[model samples]
Target: MSAMLRKWVLWLLGLYFVGGSGAALAALPIEHWTQPDGARVYLVRNDTLPMLDVRIEVDGGSRRDPAALAGLAAATAMMLGRGVGPHGGQPALDENALVEAWADLGAQWAATATLDRLSITLRTLTRPDLLERAVALAARQLAAPAFDAAVWARERDRLIAAWREAQTQPDTLARRRYAQAVYRGHPYGVEATPDTWSAIDPAAMRAFYRRHARACDARITLVGAIGREQAEVIATRLLAGWAAHGCEPLPAVPEVAPLERSQDVRLPFPGAAQAHILVGRPGIARRDPDYLPLLLANHIFGGGGFTSRLMREIREQRGLTYGVFSHFLAGRHAGAFTVALQTKPDQADLAVELVRESLRRFTVEGPTDEEIAAAKASLINGFALRLDSNRKVLDQVAAVAWSDLPLDELDTWTARLAAIDRETLLRAWRRVIDPERLVTVVVGGQP
Candidate 1:
């Protein structure tokens, strides 16, 4: 094999043997710095392989979409890599040209939009020349997006069609209605309906990009075979000319008030054999003190696969459905805790009641000592998988940067899990979860 290929193989083996251990993985050092233009940078130096992963996250995501333009943030993110204006009086680069430029250097790039941030990630070999070129290309994309009208028209139509197609699916309908029920007048509840899409023209998209994608709001996370000094230089160069102009700070997410009473809504789906049910309510933010405890508690409650109470009681014993699972999607602001299930339409009502009972039991009685120990063991042991590679570590680092979490959060994860006892778990569950106020949405049948 080539030398690069052999190096990669050995690196993979080392990660499997060394990073596979929870303690060793957590001990990896992370460095932090800031650029002159006010962009924050986080770095982890891993010289195991000759590759680098860079992510630029801005505080602009779907939640920032204007009231009239529901999909504006997503559209802006997608357009960033489509085309760029002429740099230094040179010719412009279109989407295909941009792809070819990266391909020639064995690099890859992508853009993603979430509720709280828009992230652009680039991965390239760490050879000085290749790294320099990749950084220049990314800078162009971020600083001088063309927002071509032709490209916007085509992509907009495609997005609208995808939304229309999703509307026909039972699960999608249930999720949309569930968001509406849980978030009611909040931005989190907004979805890209047909009318919302109609209001998003090219000009509006350009305006949204300018108003949200500012350097001041950016956070950079670099991982792989690079040092602290090189990372600082790279970050500064990549963001040199980018500035915050006409940019507005993201509005604070409103507090999610508890529901006064339980709400249930059912929608019809013609000829669907199975029912899609969603039970949930507003959940905690990522920064909440009870986040970790609730996470561990939920694992025993429903997120532990077959080992969880919901799976064992609702599926293994009673055979009400093929699968049942629950999750808490903690965002920058308040998020959602949801239990989702699919079952034959005939068993819909019983399945809903069973799920409700299971939640109530979990909330009131809390997890047993045995259940808690098993959950702690599973979570603590499995965390090594989350840091097995530079890519995974970069993702965690980016999340910490964007969410303003403690830099040592990953290092202390196992210790925190170990500290949760029966009382702690019960207190967190009682404080954050209220089974009586959950909103339920059933699609494809009446429950």
Candidate 2:
């Protein structure tokens, strides 16, 4: 094997053995500091590779968009990397020039919008000159997006087309309607329809960017072969010039009310060979005390792939569907627990009933001690793969910072997983999972 491939293999094997020991990996010594402009910064120094990864998460996403303009925050995030004219005396940089500059420095950058935050990520070689240049370019993009009129018009059209196309997909439609039914009048339920996209004017997007993407609400995480001093310098350069804004606090996410009864909705799709099934209800938030237990419980119930009860019962035993799985989303606020699967249209009803039964059984009896132990073993041992690289580590760091999770959570993850007993798992399941309250949406012909 080539040297690089051989090195990676050995590295993975080493992590696997570490996981097998049931020992938590030592946490990265995360250094926390605040930028002059009030951006929160978290850094971890790992000189194992000559690379740097930076992620900036602002407390603004779809949840913050005006109800009338559901896609505004998403559109704003999409426009951040496009181009920016001179602002506060800085020179202009068009989208192409900005991209070429990063290419010249052997770096890359991208942005994404989510339910709770908008994240902008950058990666580059850890050489001081390259890192500095990349950070400066990112800062400019974040601080002064041009929101060019022509570009906004084109992007608006593209977004509308994409939404229209998505409406034709059964799985997409099922998931969207499921969220709407579950959240019901909550901001989380608001989806971007064609009208939402069409209403997205450049002026509104620019205003939303300025209001929500300020340094005051930004959480920055950096992982690289750099020292504390260098990391601080990079962060300052990236955030110092942005003026802080006194934006209104984010609206509190209302508690998701339990379903009064099981609701089933079916939408017919012409010539659909399979039915898309979504079963779920409101779940816990990231900081919920039951989060860990729910996570462990989910693995045995459905999130563990073929090893899960749902998959075993529905697919392997009954042959109801090819795949079935469940997961808790754990967002900034109370999120969702979703079980998704697909089967022949004629078998849709049976599949739904089987899913409900699986959930009922799992919650009522919970997983056995052996099952819990096995689940914990699998989850703990597999986690090392998540921190196998600088980029992956950076992603974890960003998650912790943005979610306001404890700094040592990553270091203690395996130990925490190993510590959960069967009782704890059962208690979490009883408190969180409710099959009777699930809202089911199936898209296809009736069975």
Best by lDDT: 1
lDDT of 2 by residue, 267-332 (tens): 998887889999998888888988999999999999999999998899999998888899998887
lDDT of model 1 at residue 152? 83
- Model 1 TM-score is 0.93
161-199: candidate 1 lDDT, tens digit per residue? 998898778999899899989988677788877788778
TM-score of 2: 0.93
- How many backbone overlaps does candidate 2 show? 0
Error of 1 at 420 (Å): 0.6
Scored by CA lDDT, what does every candidate get? Answer: 0.83, 0.82
